[model samples]
Target: MAITEIPKGFKTLLPDEANKREKILTSMERVIKLWGYNPLFPPTVEFLSTFKAVDEKFEEIAFKVVDRETGKLMAVRPDFTPQVARIVASSFKDEAPPFRFYYKGKVFRDVEGERETYQIGFELIGVNEPEADAEIVSVVVNILENLGLKSFQIDIGNSEFIDGVIEELQIPSPTTFIKLLSSKDISGIELFMEEHHISGERREKILTLLDLYGREETLDKAAQIFQNEQSLSAVKRLKEILEILKSYGFESKVIFDLSERKGMKYHTGITYEVFHPLLGCSLASGGRYDQLLKKFGRDLPATGIAVNVDSLQLLLERKGIFKEEKKDFYIIDLKKERKLAYEIAKALREKGFSVARDIIKRSIEESVKTAFGKGYRYVIVLNRELKTPHHIYLSSEKHFPLDDKNLIESILTAVKEEK
Candidate 1:
């Protein structure tokens, strides 16, 4: 007997889908690198405590395994940022003030039944000022525009603002109130407020004034409700970040959501989530984790953004922005000139063409049919002649001389003319 099923929430990516994902990751990585971020590849597994150091919440969903060598506990990487923190403390401890790194990898979690998803993210360590946070936010906004995203918004908020709101409300169970507010239970929130004797002006302000704080005026309206220094400071910082975004001409792509306090436990300051009208969930999210590095023995300030490649790929595919790459030339060997076939394939590839040689022992007609079916635009049938193979266009009966002297030029001309 054999196991025929993968676990629930896990899925394999075939060629087409995988190609889309890779393209999305590539575009994101390019932008991240341009912003002075070097690439870092964290291992797929680490000690369970590495992740738990950031947040014990990871212990629940993290896939744990026992190490036989040391008999200590280890686990598959549930997230990359924690591993980055570990590296910063253990490896780059004596380095410098500001360290910038970007990464692309998969993270495992049991939130939706033990699924693994790809993440392409940037981590800027050793910077505490709001400029660091602003840079991260602007980089993401730049990425969205670079990827041709026309309609999207980043919902920004601060944990201090949220905590102040809870304080101002003076509710019995802040935890329960937060849960209800997070789920947007209008009736439930009202009932809870009534239960806590939170009526009159406070209730009216929350109900009518803070429906959706997207515009600048709404930010002011929301600011009027919170009186605590932390919340007011959160509001002031948000306005400063907005001014910075305005300098980048990206203020239009931003909105404020004071109710957004739910994120990774490590996010201690301003947090944000990316949204589009078409997707039901956030496409990317990040925040300032000023205290995460302290767990690793380095009290460094950090901020970063993590893009959900799986979700981004889904959105791109739905928009038909990315498609499966097609082969440029398919080599079908008719005379069994194996050496010539290999040489021709290599030559085509060297000339910037994607070529695939016929591996299956099949007839020329069958091979040609397969090439056409697989979306190849050019097909070459190799025979006894070393100097020339019949280069046939898969779309029509047109043929070109596949001479060694002009192999690249001929293909380039053909592709240019086709375009």
Candidate 2:
């Protein structure tokens, strides 16, 4: 057999890229933690039935394999919210309202384009108030800003309004129209309506949904078009959520889009999509799913947002903001000086310095070149006898000797002075 490739839509991040990814994740964790959101670890694989329980549609997108032990189907997690919901319903069954969780991991799906994606997201569970929705929006803004993303927009919508309109209109096969609306394929929706012989006031009202977007005033225009009480209430809820976001000073970051039903399958109420100019698709997307926990044998309201970590990393790269700071010290240990070099390296690391010991056998000159190439600021050379004052190569081609007793302090002082 020929050599098999690693399959499509999968990427391996080299050390530099991986370092940047970790920095992005760390920044996101810091912001989320500031808001009191604790971390949650959901299993990467779960019973296939658990996923189908929330949305049968997931069966088409989720990857599955038979469990060797149980002889049952297991699914690689396609989404975090469902697994989180399962945990909340079963593990935290007795826990009170308002459980906030933040997660960072890979979600697998048998998608046509990308099979796996990195996601950093948060979930707010057991709250039905508009405040919960506003919190989700605020958290998204905070994370993006903290990550140094200067240009981004959050599009907001109410899935309940779309569902209610479909129910009130008694439209057949609403799913197709929902897809068309999600893509903003207005012409396709019009064609679909025409094909279904849907005209008159009903068709016009459905068409009006596409036009309801942009600033806060759009909510006023939406209320005038919605006839169903549920749809009206959804608009009111969205308006109230916007008011809350406004109070948080994120009003300008939001745009109302009633036609956005992308997550309609599981999202029961308000939905949102985060976009940046660097990518055509959303950088993150999430919404309120009040009924998702019910599938796990509990009733709870929840809202969540999942940031496309890989995409955000790309944005940072394009903006030249994702950079890995250089390591502080690279110590070259001659074969005979290994033990002493190890001791010095350990002590440096204990004092909060990034220290690397060279285990590879190379000449002192080659080791110095390697250290500079690897972006290390200071290079310490241990001779065969491991002399008391080791040779130190400073950044400006200056060479000096640092005694073993003053190694840590001298290196730190040099670093601080350079800074």
Best by TM-score: 1
Per-residue CA lDDT of model 2 for 210-325, tens digit only, reads 88888888889888888789889999999899889989999989999886576747888888899988788789999999999998989998999999998888888888885658
Model 2 score (lDDT): 0.86
Which candidate has the highest lDDT of all? 2
Model 1, CA-based lDDT: 0.81
Clashing pairs in model 1, backbone N/Cα/C closer than 3 A: none
Candidate 2: regions farther than 4 A off = 1-4, 167-172, 198-204, 384-389, 403-405
Worst 10 contiguous positions by lDDT, candidate 1: 384-393
CA shift of 86, model 1, Å: 1.5
* Model 1 lDDT per residue over 1-419, tens place: 35978788887998778777777777888888899999999999898889887889888998899999888788888888899999989899899879999988889987775389888999899987777878988899888788878798998888888787767766578888767867888888889888888888778755752474676765687677767788888888888888888888888988888764757888987887899887888999889898988999999999888998888877777776765578788877776448877876787788778889888988767888888898887887766244564565647466666555665567677767867
What residue runs in model 1 are displaced by over 4 Å at the alpha carbon?
208-212, 384-389, 400-412
